[model samples]
Target: MEKNDKFPTRKDMTYWIIILILFMVGSFTVYYGSNKDMVSHIGFGGTIVSILLAVIAIIYSFYQSSTYESTTYKLDTSAQKIEEATKQLSDVSEIKTVLESFKGEVKEINESIIDLKGISNNIGNGVNSMKESFENTKTTFFESFNPISPKHVEVDEIDFSTNYFIKMLDNGGNFPLFTLALANQAHINKISKVNLRQYNKIYMKFLMGGKQADLGKDIHEAFRNIQFGMLSAYKSSRFVDIDFVEDDFIQINDINENLSQAIVHKVESLNDEQDGDKPLYDFLLTMKNKLSWDEE
Candidate 1:
């Protein structure tokens, strides 16, 4: 038979029955027995049995109290868990409501996107038409607007221009010196570099050349002369500018002239320093004299 978990088991009931029967036997012995000592012993045994019963009752009451406390704790824990679950469900419901509102806003955005896609398709078609028109005009646009494209200079034009420029530099109003005075220094430098390096080389080759001939120092001399002239012109141009600006050229010139004179005198004083060894001085002073012009 399965053991019942009910408060009193069969074994406990049997123990209680045995104890009560002993108590009854002792009571009867005390009441009716003729021997005085036997009666007194039975009386004392009954008292002890009664005390065991009282102790058992007290133990049972304590067990019941502990069981009640345990059940109450379990109930309290279940109630707290249930309250937390209810709070979580309320939060989930609030989140669902927010999501429902967001769904309507997303639907509106999707509708706007669909309309925008249609408008964009029309814009794309218009752009395609404009792209074709631009493609047709592309070559002319670059030819007009592009600054990097090389100019179309004829061979004869180059020849005539070179001769005329040299003649003007030699005889006519000194065009380059006048240009240096009028134009910005940076602009003048740019023009000089292009002409001296590229056009001058071409002009020299055209004027005198076997296919493989070297026009050695002719181009070099021209380049140096251009440099010196530019410097001299720039110096003179500064004077003209200061004069126009009502600044005394001589006052400004005096400081620069003194500085220049000091540098020259320093170099000259080195002559005295190197009096014993002229070659060392001479080596340092290579190309010290002004270079003669081609006409000279």
Candidate 2:
């Protein structure tokens, strides 16, 4: 049934048939002779040569059959190896494709990291700029009002210590002048126990549009006089009534309200060409919270 099988089988049959014919011819020549002695003498050499030839032919057929089988086996093995190698190459190609995809994803991740770093740097720069701006505004606010000399007072001066109120006075607008006068009157009464009722009187006077010609100078004098009086009282410990001073006009809400109004007015007066007012506003709020008005 196999293609190669047919060829080898046919060759083997041909070799066997030739050997059988030689053996039959040699046997017949010996058996059917006219004289037994003559047949033996004539056929002996020929029979021996034919028998040897038949043996050589049979051996050659077996050797050729073995060679064909070995060649066929080697061809089959080589074909199987080629098939396995092809399969391995295909698998390697698939692995290469997967590796390429992985590389692309890694590239994208690296780009994202770069973008995030850029964003972080921008945020840091913005925060630094804001901090610098705040510091500058703070310096300006404090420098605007210089402190009064210690030697310039009639009565002992109360170093309210914080210069914010004085600075507000220096900013100079009608509201600041009125607020300073109010604070001064309160400070004088606290220390002197003068019972002047100046706060009630002045509040009414201002409400009724008191004279404005010399009002500014009057408020400044009153502020200085009150500072000296409070300082004198503090040194003697004669008017050390913390409750009395704290309960008067220097309450937290009252100071905050005055400062808020002053700041609003200042910001509103600025021209369109002016810078932002947020820093100044924040400075005022910080100052308001820090106002202790206590002796320290």
Candidate number of the best TM-score: 1
- Candidate 2 per-residue C-alpha lDDT over 1-296 given as tens digits, one digit per residue, 9 for 90 to 100: 64574555877989999999999998887677667777686688788889999999999989999999999999999999999999999999998999999899899989989987876575455435434533443343333332453322223245332343333434443333333333433343343332223343343233333421222443434433443444333334432232234312332112233333443445433322464445334433332232323222
Candidate 2's C-alpha runs over 4 A off are 1-54, 65-73, 76-80, 110-114, 117-121, 124-296
lDDT of 1 by residue, 121-184 (tens): 7555544543353343333323322345442222343343333323322221222322222222
- C-alpha displacement of 60 in model 2, angstroms? 3.1
Q: Global CA lDDT of candidate 1, please?
A: 0.44
Question: Global lDDT of each model?
Answer: 0.44, 0.47
Query: What is every candidate's alpha-carbon RMSD to the true fold?
Result: 25.0, 19.8
lDDT minimum window of 10 residues, candidate 2 = 246-255
Give the C-alpha lDDT of model 2. Answer: 0.47
Q: What's the distance in Å from true for residue 211, model 1? A: 67
**TM-score per candidate, in order?**
0.32, 0.31
